[model samples]
Target: MSSSDIFIGEIIGTAVLILLGGGVVAAVVLKRSKAQNAGWLAITFGWGFAVLTAVYMTGSLSGAHLNPAVTLGIAIKDGEWGNVPVYFAGQLLGAMIGAALVWVAYYGQFHAHLTDREIVGDPADKAIEGPHDTKNTAGPVLGVFSTGPEIRNVWQNLATEILGTLVLVLAVLTQGLNDSGKGLGVVGGLMVAFVVVSVGLSLGGPTGYAINPARDLGPRIVHALLPLPNKGGSDWGYAWIPVVGPLIGGALAAGIYNIAFA
Candidate 1:
């Protein structure tokens, strides 16, 4: 595909991916929403469907490699680095756009959730911090925009993220073999979507399975930048784990694919 096509396709595809993926989290987490507390099953299925929709919509244009790890894995597999930057740019920008849209869509819900003294806790108990306070850990609404560890061990969190992303990129790389090497076509999208849901269900407990760098970083940045009251810290201290771990996982998946599957 041409650079322009790849860029535009990735932008639109990743935007839609994050819109639905992040939207699901907002629906479950935000107060006053009908889907509030719909639980993890809803989140897993919602993300799977998001992947299915985005892939089918943009597969023709850019193969819909909406995740940076997926793009890196494909680049390594195919030895095509020319378009990697374009894909990364588009995915990050698209992710931010989609996250912003989520806030827009859930404007009232966000206001209600954040302003709730019960949810944010008593202001008298703790001083109110800015939306992007770096010292504090994740805020109540941060989970909607990004992933965080339930238990914060550096090695454990890194390993979990790497493992989750390895499964994802490895599955993506080997998908062509299942369909006679045509890339992720119609059936492949559905298959990959299930893989995502499976990853979330099985391996997501530790660090929320941030298998995609752009998926985490882009929205975290948005969470920091957006004007949400009582929106607590962006948890910048743990930010690098999601980004670095996924890239390492993608590269590792490529190496394994080269050795075993190639």
Candidate 2:
């Protein structure tokens, strides 16, 4: 694909991916939504379908490497770094755009969810502590857009993401993926979607399975910048785990693929 095709395709595909994926979370978590508290199965399937749809839409153009980890893995596998920056830029931009759209789509629910007096707290005044084993936070709702560790154990959380992403990138590699190994074909897309759902169900409880760097970073960035009412801290302290863990996992997967699977 041409640079323009890759950039535009990734931007559009990734935006659609987050819009649907995050939309499901908002439906399940925000107040009074029909799907509220619908539980993890719903989220896993929602994200699976989101990946399938986005890949189908952009598989030909930019290969729909919507996740930065996937982009990195493919680059490492192929030893072509020239296109990496364009792909990353598009994915990040798309994620932010998708998150903003979700805010618009769930505007009423966001307001209702935040306005509830029980969870309302001044973001400027709170101590802004991390997510301990305490149910003490009320607002940010960034979990809908990104990932967060349930237990807040740094090493454990990072390892979990690395393992989960290893499975993901390895699955993509072992399948003889296309688009410079950045995307999957129709069958491959559906299979990878199932891999994502599998990761969420099996490994998600600890840290919410942020196997994709852009999937977390872009939305977290949006959470910080957007004007969500009384939204709590953005939890920047735990942000690096998602981005770094996935990158490490991708590189490791590439190395393994080259060493054994190739």
Candidate 3:
């Protein structure tokens, strides 16, 4: 495929990824919304569908590495070292743009559903309510790109994200190796869906399994820009966990695959 073709595919694929992945979070977490508190099932299915759409759209050209972590992992495994930076930049840029679009699409809801006071919150209460209550609205408003533990400490939260991403990437590699040329046309999609479902069902409650960096950072920039009620966008203390966790997990998965199959 031409470079331009791959670039366009990456853009479109990443946009779809953010839309569906972030969109689901908005549906489930937004106030007085239809899907609020719809639980892990909805999130998992939403993400699974997002992956399916992205892969179908860009897999032929760009391999649909919507997640930078995934791109990095693939480069490590296949020695596509020169293309790593280009892919990473494309993924990040696409992610940010996609996240901005999500904020725009949900603009009306954000204003109508929440008040400015809620976004900023009271300084005194910030310490207490910031982490807990923030999850309810912050994730949907900013971007569904990161993960954090509901009540656990930072270490546990980070661990949860890492482990979740590990499972996700491992599943992807396993399916790619075992199902290739076996008529598993859509099995990759199904595998992704099942892996996400497993994580959400079992491990989501702790950290909202943000196994992807672009998913979080891109939307976060949007959240900071978009005007919404009571939006604090405090960067959630240490925002790096989502990015680092996923990378760690992706690399670990690649290494494990190499050891086992190579």
Candidate 4:
């Protein structure tokens, strides 16, 4: 694919991925949305369908490598790094746009959730600050945009992300094996969606299963920039784990694929 094609496809596909994926979170978490309190199963399935839609829409253009981790894994497997930056750029841009769109789509819900603290408690009030006490300061509603560890153990959190992303990239790497032992058709895309859903169900608890760097970071940037009430802290301290872990995981998966499969 041409650079333009790759860039456009990644941007569009990833944007759609985040829009629908994040939309589900906002719906489930926000105060008055119909889907509020829909639970984790809903979220996992929502994300799976988001991936399904995005992949189908952009598969022809850039093979729908909407996630940076997937792009990195593919690049590592192929031993060609030329288009990696382009893929990253496009994915990040798409993530941001998708996050913004989510905000727009749930504008009323966001306002409702933030304005009525009694009805919809502030997330930062429960944010961990000290060993025993929580902080009173307002924090950003970052969960809808990014991932956070349920238990704040650095090593454990990092390990969870590494393992989760490892599963994701590994599945992506070995998506569809034809007679030639390469290539993923439509079946592969659908399989990837299920793998994502499986990873979420099995591994999402640790750090919300941020298997893709762009999936987490792009929306994070938007959360920081957007003008939302009581948006709270972006939790930059915990941000690195999602980014670093997924990159490491992708590399590890690629390395494993090259060693065992290729």
Candidate 5:
């Protein structure tokens, strides 16, 4: 594929990924919806299917590294460094557009439902009265954009994200695209899906297993800009962990793969 074709394919592939992966979250979390609170199993399957479809469509042209961390990992494994910026930018931009589409797809429901202020029982008090109360106002918006643990703290949350993403990237490096005697093909996509499921089942309760910076940050930005009944703060406090954790995990996985093979 030409450079332009690869770039366009990456954008389209990432958009499809976020549309399905992130869209499922919006479906389950937003109020009065069909899939509300459906639990981790549903999310795991949704993401798995999303990745499966994306890979089938664009894996040949762009390798379908929808996550920036995955792209970085591939770059470490002999992928051209010059294409790094193009792929990363395409993924992020596609994620943002996909997230915006999700919001648009669910706009009617978001606007018709109760606002965050009302959910917090302040209806009158726009300011969050307490941390616990903050959830009532923030839950709907943040819930759709990213995952937060039931327990809140920076270090623990960060640890969960790092550990989860490390497991995910490690799986990707070893089982995803290697020159094993058994070669990777259709099963590789299935393996990727299973990795996401494992993360969701085990560590998803904490930090919502964002693992992908574009997945969280792109949607969060949309949640801030879009008109909803009641939106809360962007929850920037824990944003760094999702970004840093996945990058670290991807790099760690690549390093481990290099060492094990060498």
Candidate 6:
């Protein structure tokens, strides 16, 4: 694909990816939404379908590598670096746009959720000022945009993210295999969607399975920037884990694929 096609395709594909994926979380978590309290199963399946839709929509234009981790893995596997920056830029921009769209779509729900005293506590009571309290760690609705761990253990969180992303990128790397060990198709996009759902169900407990750097970071940045009352910190301390771990996982998956599958 040409550079313009790749850039435009990634922007559109990733925008759709985050819009649906983050929109589901908002639907389940935000007040006044009919799907509120729909639970984790709903979230996992929503994300899977989000991936399916985005990939199918843009696969022809740019191969639909919507996630930066997937882009990194593919680049490493193919030894191509020239377009990596374009992919990264498009994904991040698209993610931010998607997140903003989610906020717009759920504007009333966000206001209701954040301002509800029962949900976010008294606005006048002041935020908890502790070294490791939940209030200071993350905003009330940050999960709609990014991932966070139930238990804050750095090593465990990092390892979980790395492992989840390793499985994801590795599966993506090998999904094109045919019966004759040659180039062919095997419902690759649908299989990748299943892999995402599998990763979310199996490994999401530890760190919410932020296997895609762009998916997490771009929206997290938006969360920080948006003007929402009582929206707490963006959890900058934990931010690097999602970004770094996925990149490391992508690189490691490339290495493993080169050794075992390539």
lDDT of each: 0.84, 0.85, 0.68, 0.83, 0.71, 0.84
- The CA lDDT at 216 in model 4 is 93
Candidate 6 pairs with clashing backbones: none
Q: Evaluated with lDDT, which candidate comes out highest?
A: 2
Task: Please identify which of the two predictions, 4 or 6, would achieve the higher TM-score against the true structure.
Answer: 4
- Candidate 2 lDDT over 1-262, as tens digits, reads 8999999999999999999999999999888799998999999999989999999999889887888888888888888999999999999999999998999999999989888876565342233336241332544377877888767789999999999999998888887376455567777888889999999999998998989998899999998898876676688888999999999999899899999977
**Residues 1-262 of candidate 1: C-alpha lDDT, one tens digit per residue:** 7889989998999889999999999999788999998999999999999999999998888888899998888888879788899999999999999889999999999999888767665433222133334343224488888888877788998999999999988988887323434246787788899999999999988887889998999999999999888777777878999999999998999999999989
Measured on C-alpha atoms, candidate 4 has an lDDT of: 0.83
Clashes of each: 0, 1, 8, 5, 0, 0
Using TM-score as the measure, name the better of candidate 1 and candidate 2.
2
Cα error, candidate 2, residue 45 (Å): 0.8
Higher TM-score: candidate 1 or 5? 1
Worst 10 residues of 3 by lDDT: 176-185
What TM-score does candidate 1 reach?
0.92
On TM-score, the stronger of 2 and 6 is 2
| lDDT per residue (tens digit) for residues 1-262 in model 3 | 4556656767788888888787787778666668888976888888878877877777766767677777666666666666666566777778777776766766666665556455434443333224445434333344344444456577887788889888887777767422222111355766766676787777777767778887777666666666655555546565788888889999998898778955
Residue 244 C-alpha lDDT in model 4: 94
Error of 2 at 81 (Å): 1.3
Between candidates 2 and 6, the one scoring higher on lDDT is: 2
**Considering lDDT, which of the candidate structures 1 and 3 is the better prediction for this target?**
1
Segments of candidate 1 deviating more than 4 angstroms: 122-139, 176-183
TM-score of each: 0.92, 0.93, 0.83, 0.92, 0.86, 0.91
Clashes of 2: 1
Whole-model lDDT, model 1: 0.84
List candidate 5 stretches off by more than 4 Å. Answer: 116-136, 178-185
